[model samples]
Target: MEKLLVIGLDSVPPDLLFGKLLDSLPNTKRLYRDGTHGTLETCHPPITVPAWMVMMTGKNPGALGIYGFRHRRGSSYTDGYIVDSRHVSEPTVWEILGERGLKSCVIGLPPSYPPKAINGCLVTCMITPGPEKEFTFPQSLKNEVRRVVGEYAFDVTFRVEERDSLKRELFEMTKKRFKLASHLAREKDWNLFILHEIGFDRLHHAFWKFFDPDHPKYVVGNKYERIAEEYYGLFDELLGDLLEAAGADVPVLLLSDHGSKAMKGAFCINQWLEREGFLKLARPPLGVTEFEKAEVDWTRTMAWGWGGYYARIFLNIKGRERGGIVPPEDVPALKSELKRRILQLRDVSGRPMKNSVFEPDELYGVARGDKPDLMVYFDDLNWRSAGTVGHESLYLSENDTGPDDSVHSMNGIFLYHDPNNHQNQIKSMNAEEVAPTILNLFGLPIPDGMKGRAVKLS
Candidate 1:
């Protein structure tokens, strides 16, 4: 009852549990045979930061005050603030446990930028920098996060190689991360031990063609499927290693924040903005021509942008506080107008959703006060929106007919094991049931904030 181990694998969709190539995944299937299981419902919009935070604080994003990435946009530059404990209004699971004289170990969970004060070990993830020296966790555990990410943890840039060595490096890192977590579990005698794997999320982003049969990126002429094969195969081995490492005396759980797909087609938010009078343009954008910059009006335009699983269109009311069109009195009308306009477009495939955007309320059933103003789900569920005002990839060039060709689904995979039997049984589950069950398992108080029910462990 004093020891619980949680392994977080990002972007693992629940449907991958069948007899297909992924279903044949030996260790995952073995895990099902050995454990009592169900889906862990991720946070609304199912993005990584929000979902994990929900698990940590046991509060909704609205209540927690981390509404999808950061503070609201300012017109020109829209870099989001990294989520931190200052923004968390309620006590987290770690804090609650610590109050009860129990210690916990937390590592590499996103938006841990400011680094919360936790018992035992505190290795922060998604932490930003002016100095790495500022947030190093006891030097020893900091070394572990580095062991998985190397120098790239601080500055993640693109690599030119295909799924060759880079993919192998990721798998090796996944192996080490879990191994390190297992080592920590043996080392710490506490109520909760958590390790979130960044591999699955990266795999979904970089190797979608292999798992997604519908991707335009996939080709019969290439080795894409091999990417999925090798990635999952290695993960299966790692899960087995984790199971063996834990030695079957404690509850071991596997879960993901969200699932993914490579989406094509970008709905130019600026395009929509200009059309709706929410945005103004400098000159000619992607498809426009014969425009003179001097003749175009800039004072009247707003900004529009997108990203995987999300989008935003807002007025340029940042500094013009005295006389801005989106004034305090107009905020209500503007939000409604933005929501109405986004729902009008469709993806290239003609699905009503590809071009639609849902506000936070629509996505999570949470109140408007706690959610982002707009949540857009692409057509085919594979189409994505751009987060930047003007992106080059939104429009198809003469040679490119496909949309962005990159996407991800917040829907993901979950696995749970019994402490008594090593490998006994398994099943499917919806994502919403995850939080309540874990709190129930830890014997922690479940807040009224959660909409999910605890899965029965007995």
Candidate 2:
């Protein structure tokens, strides 16, 4: 079997690749010309954590029991925990490959903290505590990584409010990621190699404001206007180096968990819930507050929400929550009403903001752990969902976390290159199809329970 190489670029957009930055990204352009490429539809609420897992495990978030980075462990909102790879119940493609005695090198995929043992090396990503912690499989590779590259960056420091410092930090981190990935590609012999870079995601989040002049926060003549474009150019150069190391005969798969778009603003969902009488706070907040710390009156609160790139609501139901109020019989009616009200929500200009609201039962069609009653998108991905309740009005000035410019979009990029085939092959794909497709490339059976079918590349 030809060796399979998977390069995961978290949150890479097609517009930038094929449209905006194509001329300068020569390697990527050549990949596009030489192989099959298309938009890979991502999992809903397409953030890093669950989307990449979907690509690896070939399962939906509901089946995996991982909705996002932070998931509710119990019925209470306070019971939420930062999701890690340990939380994943399904075996990843690498784990399955390992069972088949195939050597695999996996690096820097999200929620990969506390690296799991693999047939080959492992480098944890995103929530890796720090360089001081154990971030590699053999434990000794962490030191070697640091020795080769001064500091192995799991993620860029993304507090966009600190623009000047963030630019310098992001560049340094991008270079370090490329350096480490190049070293690892040549350091070991493996049947499959996987490496995910978070720099594209971080760059889009931080500098999307400067790149898109029409963004509400975009500044004219900003020094960082072309930062994202330039980074794409640098990434192309890195791709050339890495491909040189991987050699000519290997089949390459380039993928991103999700795409990114300009964020208009944040919609404070908790505040909206309070206004709608579904949620109640014990006292007026003095300053910026989080839902878990807001001291809510659960006895009176029938429903409340927590926020992220999207909004997630929990029904305060009897027999479920600590101070349950909404009875079992009343559940459906309440959900309907909640959905109706959410649809009625509007932006500051009074234009309808919400794109759609989802119920896990309707979407996933089965019971899942710690499922949210409703999932929401606003203004078709231009707005973020804010979880706080202290705001004087429905809207907040900016993201409470930081000055974020980009929001996640459901469409990500996928490019497949086969050394033997030159024609345009499969044109479009889903995030789940990737794992099954790779398994098929190795002449392995697609797991019967997987939600996707392998694409025919011959």
Score each candidate by Cα lDDT.
Answer: 0.59, 0.85
Measure candidate 2: CA RMSD: 1.5
Q: In lDDT terms, how accurate is model 2?
A: 0.85
Model 2, TM vs. native = 0.97
Q: Write candidate 2's Cα lDDT for 1-458 as tens digits.
A: 64888999989988888677888888988888888988989987698989999899998888887778888878865877888878888988989999989998888988788988889999999798898888999788888898989877777778657788877777778788778877888888788999899988988888888988878878889898889778888889988888877778877889999999988888898888888889988998888798888989888999888778899989989998888999999999998998888888789998987578898877776647777888988878788889986777778657878778889998999998876777565488898898898899899999988979998755
Cα RMSD (Å) per model?
4.7, 1.5
The sequence of per-residue lDDT tens digits that candidate 1 reaches over residues 1-458 is: 56667777767766654335556588777567666665555665567767777766656665565656655533333334556645666666667678878877776677665666677776656445623554445556666556644542421211224556656667666766666666766665666777777776677666666556776656765665666667777778777776666566767777777766565555554455656666566555554322221223445644344444555444445454222445556666776777666566655455565355555555545543333455556564455544444345333211122223345565666767766656444455444455566677778777676666676654
Q: Per-residue error at 122 for model 1, in Å?
A: 2.6
Judge candidate 1 against the unseen true structure and give its global Cα lDDT, from 0 to 1.
0.59
